[model samples]
Every structure is written in C-alpha cells, then in structure tokens.
Target: MCQTLRQKHNLTVRRQDVMLMMADLDPVGIEQRSRRRFVRRVYHSLGPNHVWHVDGYDKLKPYGLAISGCIDGYSRKVMWLVCGASNNDPDIIAHHYLQCASEFGVIPKLLRTDCGTENGTMAAIHCSLRSTHTDDLAGASSHMYGSSVTNQRIESWWSYFRKQNVLQKDLDECKEIWNTHTIRAVNQSRCPSGKPDAMYALPHRFNGRECGFCISQENLNEFFVELTRSTCGDGQLQAHFEELHAQSNLTTSYTWEAGVENYITLKNMAHI
Candidate 1:
C-alpha cells in the first residue's frame, strides 16, 4: 500500500494510514484477510542465491506459449523469467537456467523445485554443476524436489503475477518489473523489506551473506557436450524463435498485446 501510494501518487504514506483507509474503504476485504489462516512451515535461507525456487506458470500455456521462472528464496529476487515455446522442454528450461546463471557468473547453493518431469533436465544439470562445490547442499543433493504448494518463493510469485494481470509479454521486461517490486515486511520476521535487486546485490546491507558459488565456463561446456551427445539420436527442439527473431527486425521487447501480434508474425515467418 505504501509502495503503491509512493509509486502511483508520489505520496509516501504510512502503513498505519493505509490500514485505516483500507478498513474504511474495504472493510470486508480487511476482515477476510485478517481471518485467513496460514499453515505453519519451517523454512529458512542463508541469503540471496542460497536457494532458487524454479517453477512454471501454466495459466498462459493454452495460448501456445509458456512462462517459466526462477526466484531467489531469500531475497525474493526473480533470477530468471523466460517466455518460450514450451516450458516443459528440458533443453529450453536448462537453457534459461544456464543463461541466467551465466549472467551472474554463479549458481545458487541450492535449487528448490516441484517434482515434475519437465524439471528433470534442470535437476540433473544443477546437480552436475554442483559436483565440485563444497556446500552442504552440493552434489547429488543440490536440487531439492517438493510439491508445488510447498515451493513457496516461486509459487508466491506466480500468484502475484496473476493478480497483477501482467500483460507485458516481453519476458525480460516483465522480469525487470517484478524484480523491482517491493515486498512488505512482516512484523517479527527476519526477512528484509526492500526491492529484490537491492537486497540481492547487497545482502550484507540486510545482514545476509551471498551464498551463490562461482562456476567455471569449462564445466558448463563439458555438460553441454554431454547433453548434446546424449540427445544425438533423438528429435531435438532447436531454438527456432531465436533464429526467426534475428531476421524478424523486431525490437527485443514487447507488451503482452504486442507480443501476441509479433509472435504470430514470427510464427508465420518460421513456417514459411
């Protein structure tokens, strides 16, 4: 509420003020929200990059597109948001993981995800990458699989993403938005309150340490070679959109409405 006021109205209102207004303007909502019960779950994280929750948002899948993303558990920063042909494809998912990790030159100490077949390749890749890391969660146990409901960070993101009716179709543009969204601080909780990017970049400011481990390009290359060798005989999903994108003469970003239009344009071109 405070953030909304500040951003939309350029007014920095107090939390108490917002509460009072919400009570008067939306009594039923406030009452219902107050009565909501939260199930107890004991979850802890060291800091940013300590654990990344990876998941797919399937609500838009019926439109012949898919959205998959990963969020840092501690800082609540979205590490990656990818819009593509199929979030279920292992190679595409793995590519998003590797590309995002490459941007930071490091991977999370641990990765939390739901037990989905689509996550198989990403799971194997994370474990393989963590082979030489000395963390407590390294090696075979580096990836933790759980139910979607319990994969809190990314799941929570999907909820908010839907609530906002995020119509921006450019994955990177959408990524920039929620990545900077402010998370309200809970009273008596140790979680920091601020924009995710700030907390992720400067964890020490919030009394947290950077928990990601640096990885070498050679390791990534070796794994890619193995991935290629293993899929040699199988039908592979090439990055056709990328090939089309280069020749499409389109800007790299688009609103959700614009993206749909541009997607059709590229799809037809690819078919041709």
Candidate 2:
C-alpha cells in the first residue's frame, strides 16, 4: 500500500504507518501477535558452511512421511531436505547428512539442532566430521538451539511448505519440488541466480564461503560403511566401501571395528 500510494498518488508514507492505518480500519482482522511490539533483532553468521541448522518436521505423520532438512547459517541456502517413513530414525537422519556432504565437497564446521531424539544420528555424523554440535536441552520445548528468532530462516520455509498444499503427495516428488524451486535473494549474500543449487556452486557470488572443508575419501567410506552396516548386509556394504575408496583414491586405513567403536562412543556421549 505504501508503494502503491507513492507510485500512483505522489504520496509518501512509511510502511509501518501504512500497516497501522490498515490495523485501525479492521482491528479484528489484524493479528494480535502482529500488533505486539518488540525490539527488532538482527542475526549474522561468519560465512556459509561455518554453521548449519538441521531439524526434522513430522507434520506429515498421518500420511506416513517425515521430512528432515539442513540449511546453511550464513547464506540461508537449504543444504538438503530428505524425506522418509520415519524422521526419528537415526539412520534416516544420518543418510540425509551423508547425502548432503556427498553432493557438496565440504562439511559444515558446526551444526545446531534441538535435542530431540530424532537428531541422534545427525549429531553422531556431525561429531564424526570432527565438527562441534550446539544443541538445545533435551525436552526443553521452549528452547531452540540458537535463538528462536534467529532460527526463523528455515522455520519460515516450513510455513510455505504447508501453504503449498503438497503434504499429501509421495515423498520423492515433494523432495524434488523443494530442491528445484527457486528462492529469490532477500539479502545480498544470497545467490545472484536466486537458486540454492546455483548459489551453492558459485560461492564467489556469496563472498567465497563455498567448499571450505573437504572430508577425505577414506573418512567418507568409513562413514558410509558404519552407516550401512545394519541398514545393508555385509557383502553389499563391503563392495560399496571398497568402491567408494577406490573411486576417491582414498587409502583404507580405518577399520570397520574402529568405526563401530567411534559410533558407539559418540552415541553415548551425545546423550550425556
């Protein structure tokens, strides 16, 4: 309305003034929450891949699908969104993290998440990367890993996810839709092309925040081997492990026994 008035009527009005005028015109129509006043807060990150926020959404539980996703802290690019039958399953969460790292050469320096049990596998994977985990307390419903206000970047996307009315469809299709959909740059650091995938590839456009950390091929193989152990049988996993190492030219110095021990240690420490 402010822009329309300025463009059409040679009238200048501030956006907040226009909002107040609208509120007076239809007081009941205005949301009470919107009317509340608070100091505006700003959030910033050092750079992309410096931190990532990962979480799961289970609103589609009645339809038997749950969504897990990660978003870069700085550029606000969504790293990946993975869907499965159970978002709470540790393996499902770990698989999505692994998949994101596979596509992007670097791993995040830090991951922030709530202390829900669903994050167990993701936390384990983050620790495996020698990355730090910043967590909200377990069962602390009011606490968010970072401030609730700061975490709004991805949480706001969930609102649009429901508005699109795509929740009832199959998981794979929903994942595809989200991955391809273009988001315009609301800030300067966002992709010039306004697509997450494009911005992800062109880090220079966002001030050189891309590909900061690369996981070794041997470590990648070990991670998947540990990840696939119970999920897939020994023969199939062995073949995959060897293939990954050979493809990446990584020396296979880490043993499966050591991987198991590392996983167990991380899991136990995560709870305490």
Candidate 3:
C-alpha cells in the first residue's frame, strides 16, 4: 500500500518547499538555522558593482571554452561574459571588461573573482591602469592595488546558470543558445522584489517615452562625490568613482572638485 502510494501520489515539490520540509525534519535544528544564516549573509553583501563573479567552464567539448562572467551584485544583471581557452590569460578578462563598458557604459566598482591563475596575474593589468602601489603598513602593496573585493553572489548566479542552462544536454550547442536565451530572459524578467528591470527603461505615462536618460557628466560627478563623502560609505561606489575618473583622464582630486564646480555652474545657469 505504501509503495503504491509512493509511486502513484508522489509529491511534485518545488525547491523552497523541499527545503522547508527538510528543515521541519531536522532533529538538531542546526541545519535549518545555518542555511538561513548563510542565505542572509549572501543578501547582505549584494550591491551594484559590489562584486564580480568569474569562473571557467569546459563542459562544452570540441571548443573547450573558458568563460568569465561578471554580474551586477545589486541588479543581478550579467555585466560581462567572455569565452576563450587558456584559463590564465588576463587579456580575456580585460576584453570582457572593455566589452561591458562599451555596451553598458558603466564600470564595476568592485571585481570579485575566484583565486584563479589568470585572475592572480595582477601585474600586467595593474601596470596598464597606472595605479601606483602604496607603501601603507599593509603587507605587499600588490594586495592593496589589485582587485580585492569578494562576495558570494556571483557564485550563486553561476550555480543557477549551470543547473538551469549550462549543464543541460546538447553541450555543443548550449553556449550560443544559453547565452542568447539567458541574457534576453534576464533583461526582460521582473525581479521578485517588484523592482524595475535594469536593462530597459520604464515607460513614462505622460509621453510614452522611455524613462532611461543618459546621466550627464556634471550630475554624475556630483552624485559620485556626494556618494563618496556621504555616511553611507560603500566600497563599490568609491571604486566606481575612481574608475570613472581614470577613464575620463582626470585625477581623483580633480574629478571631485570639478564635479562640485560643474554642479554649481549648472544650478546657477538654470537660475538664469
């Protein structure tokens, strides 16, 4: 009778429901508590540009591609995706970074990556960026100069991508198909929190115009400076400001100063 019931009336369980049932069965209760704690930790660490997660994938044969993926920790958008063999090459990572900046027009404030050989080679790209090593009391300056931010959001995204998309059959054709489908799905899908989609603009009711507007340089500068100086200190925001200053060919001090000046000028001009 039990066997017949098990076979005929088996539960169609969702992942969360299974987890809840398991928690109810756990004798010590530690498993459920620990899992909850772990999830909360992950949620607390997420922020836009807070961390970038990267890994290499080789499940697809013949081509044997190595992939590095970057995700926006806050918006959960895939910021950068690059595929190539030779896991340890910095060029691959750099190429992806450039592609992201060109397409998205934003630079990540913090890059979170695993301790891979390619990611470990900080010298080449560090020199290219012209960021000087400071002799602060900290250990080797390399540690201070190179990308140091780390988080688990990227890892979670990787697990979802692997199980839901990458690890499916048809390994040969999965890359192109998965990339196109996943990106489109993510860009269009609404977040569970009811937040607006990050990739596209919201529709303005008055004019039916897309609400997305290019952030003016003057406003951007002021916003970043205020972010840096404000009490809600975020490392990712600081990193973004630095990256933008570098890209704009302005010194860090000059960037902040100019931003303030520009904001004032714009406001004054508006008054006229």
Each model's number of backbone clashes?
Answer: 1, 0, 1
Best by lDDT: 1
Order of candidate numbers by lDDT, starting with the best: 1, 2, 3
Q: Report how far residue 234 has shifted in candidate 1, in Å.
A: 17
- Candidate number achieving the greatest TM-score relative to the actual structure: 1
How high is the lDDT of residue 220 in model 2?
Answer: 64
Tens-place lDDT per residue, model 3, 151-209, is 45556555555643332232323332332221322322232121223322222321223
Model 2, global lDDT: 0.58
Q: Which stretches of candidate 3 lie over 4 Å from their true place?
A: 1-42, 45-47, 58-63, 120-150, 165-196, 199-272
Off by over 4 Å in 2: 1-40, 131-150, 165-193, 225-272
Candidate 3 residue-wise lDDT at 244: 48
lDDT for position 114 in model 1: 91
- The candidate, 1 or 2, that scores higher on lDDT is 1
Residue 134 local lDDT, model 1: 78
Each prediction's TM-score versus the true structure: 0.76, 0.55, 0.41
Give the Å error, residue 183, model 1.
2.1
Better of 1 and 3 by TM-score: 1
Instruction: Please state the error at residue 191 of candidate 3 in Å.
Output: 11
Worst 10 residues of 1 by lDDT: 229-238
